[model samples]
Target: MLKVLFAGTPDVAVPSLRTLAADTGHFEVVAVLTRPDAPTGRGRKLMPSPVKQAALELGIPVIESDPSEESFVSCLKATGAEAAAVVAYGKILKEHVLDALPLGWYNLHFSLLPDWRGAAPVQRAIWAGDSVTGATVFRITKGMDCGPILAQSTVTIGAHETAGELLERLADDGSHLLAASLEAMAEGRIVPVEQPQGAFEVARKITVEDAHLRFDVPVFAVNRQARACTPNPGAWCELHADGDANGEPTTLHVLAARPIADDDRDNFATMLANRAGNGDADGTSASSLNPGELLVTKRKVWVGTVTDPLELEQVKPQGKKAMKAADWARGARLAPTAYVK
Candidate 1:
């Protein structure tokens, strides 16, 4: 069995750990390293990561630490590990950590390297509207995710999958890559390929300001942005009243959505307004309000935009439980030209 050390935190790391432990007789994970328990949620309770929970369940010891080289490397070396694997560890591996292992450390990154190389990968790919994404096992060089590739596997993004859904799927993609790579390593046959240098783009971390949506932007663009932030730093749109009345804008969380339907789509093919046609069934008014603004609301919610309208199938309106947009319309306190900013 290979004497291995594992370092990672978050749900992203859970899959690899589970895979290794499930097959423990082949690849023995000697120790697990993760970030310290952190203050989470509004209550600020100290919470363990999914990785920590899983490791403890399996009777594995976990070391929580900061990004400092000595702090990370010393704990790692104590495991006397032959190889190390990292996934979403939230720390940069310094040169000493890489050299400390007999076999260099490897990282399982969410995106195809040389592409989405920074903080968020699955979200970035979907936000950018790329139809393809994959997992990359690479040699952990001293830079960012700019390491050479050891193995990779690609998967398709469905037409209406949110970022959270995609990441859940890619967790399996990452599992397949890691297991195959480790098996090859056990047989002394795996080879590392260098990452191509140049023209790399940074996947900036999502900030609170990133949640704000501008209605003036194209419909498709805004749609992509919303779903990318789903289930986390959620993509949010604000509503301003047609008349005076409000304390804080109406916050809408985009959950489930699809492109405009055929009937509405045909209407949008020319001009995406007035399709619902003068108060269809619900109290919502219909007219070509400016794109990025609400157009109709009867059984469903439709937001008009420059290219096409978006049908919000599922969402959570401000201060309300998550419910179908259609259901919310019956009692919604909104009026015509209520805009989503």
Candidate 2:
């Protein structure tokens, strides 16, 4: 059995921990190092990490620390770890920490190397509109996600799939891949391929500003933004009134939508809604409304984007709780040609 130290945080890392723990005799996970407790939910009580919870159940020593490179090195030295496995560890690792491990350290990243390198690769890949993405297990190096790959597996990014959904699939697949990769390393059957050099894209962490939608751009770009931001800081845009007419202010959420073929527009301004597409009971209707215009049907609220109008399935007003867009429109002051921000 190999002596190992596992460092990780969040649900993404839990699957790896489970595999290592369950395979008792084959591997001895000496200790689990995770981020210190964080406040969660409405009451703001501090909570233990997923890794910590699993480690406790298995009777493994658990170390909770702030995810700093220095702190990680200190923890490793205490354990005299022969090897280390990291998954979504959150903290950036330093050269000394990587060097200290007797057999060295490895990371299981959510995307293929040199493509979406850095924190939040999966989300960034979708945001960039890439159709294909995968998981990679590589030797941890000084640079961010710049390491020699030990093994990898790919998966398709469906058009309407959410980031959360993609992550769930990847996590389940990657855990087994990690076990096999580690198994190979133990038997000296796997070879580490050095990463290729060149101009590769890096995944910048998503921020609040990234969520703002630009209606002036094409609907395809809008669609890309929406797909990229699914199940999190979602892609959003304003549904302004058509030519400053009667009504109060309102906005809509493009919860679920698809791009119509002929709605392409070099100029987002000229794009108009024609007799409506599919918006359903959540404030969408079949009506000949201009682009960026809004229609209230059956007391529901729908808005036309730079492309065709989308059915606003979910919506929320400024300083209000999120709810069905139609319900919100009905309660708030809303009417035809209502401007949204």
Candidate 3:
């Protein structure tokens, strides 16, 4: 068995830590490294990371500080760990610590490297509408996610899968891959392969502006944005027309949506304008409604876009509980062709 240092943060890192810890015959986890505890939740109480909590339960020593802490590197040097493994550890390892591990450090990234190679890879892949994405175990380098690949396992992205759901699956898959790679390394059968430079695309960290829903794009694009930003920063848009009783436009966050199919592109706009009164003297002008318009009927709620209309199934209004899209539309008393903005 080989002694190895394990470093990671968040719930996503817990499985990898637990796996390496439990497989005592193959590898001994000498010490666990994680970020310091910070305030969490509405009560704002200090809380240990999921990795720290798991390490304590499993009887492992936890180092909850950075590598630059006074004498921390010296203490780590005494662990006699031959190698290290990091998963979503939230910090880059310094050169001294990297050099300390004789067998080198391994990172289990959520995306197939040389493609999405930075923070939030899985979310960015889904956001870009990539049909396939997977896990990659690579040698840790000074550059961000720019490392030699050791092992990889690919999985298809579901059509409408949200980032939260896809991340859970990838975390489990990556854990197994990391454990197996460590086993191979212990047996001296693993060889790292250099990632192709030309195939690189960065996955930049998501921001508040990235979560703002844009109605000018295709319906599928809008749907992907909602899924990519769901349960995190959250994809939202402001209402431009319909106001509350106090005459203020409400901000709405889209939680779930589906694109409506229209076979006749030529007649689609005309048909929609007819179905919903087209905001004219006779209520039938095709030019009355514009893209981003909100069309409300008794049973369904559809929002216009550049391509086809999108049916909003679920939405969360500011300062209120999440409700069905139809319910929200019914209460808005929408004009013949009210723009959602």
Candidate 4:
């Protein structure tokens, strides 16, 4: 059996660690390296990383600390490990640490790379409206995710998939690829493929600004933002009362949404034009409603955009529980001409 050291953190890395630990016929996981325990949850109690918990359960020695530390290198050297595998380890390894392993280190990154060659690739792919993304097992080099490929597997993105959902699928798929890459390396049947020189996209880390939703853009773009940001910083838009003396705007967290169909969108435009020209049956000036105007009825809540109006399916208001958009709109008593910022 080939002895190996495993380094990873987070739930996404758990599947890979489990596969490597369970399959001891060809590989023996000598030890696990992960981030130190950090506070989590409401009580702020220290919590072990997912990889650390998994390793402990598997009866493997676990080290939770910075891998660049000299003491860490000394401990790794004493493990008699021939190789190391990394999956979302969350830290860049120094040259000295890489030299500690006899066969160097391999990483299982969640992207087809060369493209989306940074953090938050899966989320960025969805935000960019990409139809496909995949996992890549590569030889770790000095560059970030710019390493030579060892194995790859692709998966189609769903039309309305959220970042969290896509990551769950990719993590499962990546675990298998990581296993295969390790097996190939052990059998001497693997060759690293250098990434080609060309234009590629970088998936920069997500920021708070990325979650702010703007209604002046196309419905598809807004939908993409909602899907990409759900279950994280979360997509949100500011709602103004049109004439609030205090100038306070309510922030609405958009959890889920769908772009209207072309035909339906055309019909909605016609209806809005008529309402703008003539007072609506409810004696409200729908015509004065701007592109960012919000409408609420018994069934749903709608927001106007550049192309078509987007239906707000799920939303969360400040200091309130998540509820249907219509319910929140009704409770707020939004007027027909009320426009969101």
lDDT of 2 at 337: 48
Worst 10 residues of 3 by lDDT: 279-288
**lDDT of candidates 1 onward, in order:** 0.77, 0.71, 0.82, 0.83
lDDT of 1 at 341: 62
Candidate 2 pairs with clashing backbones: 272-291, 279-311, 283-300, 283-301, 283-302
Per-residue lDDT over 256-333 for candidate 3, one digit per residue giving the tens place of the 0 to 100 score: 887765453334455565565563235433233356787666656777778767778899888878999889878866
- In Å, residue 181's CA in model 3 sits off its true spot by 0.7
lDDT of 1 by residue, 8-74 (tens): 8889789998898778667888888888899999899999988899999999888776647456667
Candidate with better lDDT, 1 vs 3: 3
In candidate 2, position 173 carries an lDDT of: 90
Clashes of 1: 1
Ranking by lDDT: 4, 3, 1, 2
lDDT of 4: 0.83
Q: What's model 4's TM-score?
A: 0.90
lDDT of 2 by residue, 192-298 (tens): 99999997888888775687655455555666676667666766665544435443434445555445433332122222222233323334322234455555655
Write one digit per residue (lDDT tens) for candidate 4, span 156-236: 999989998999999988988998898998788999899998878988888778889887788788889888888777888
Per-residue lDDT of 220 in model 2: 59
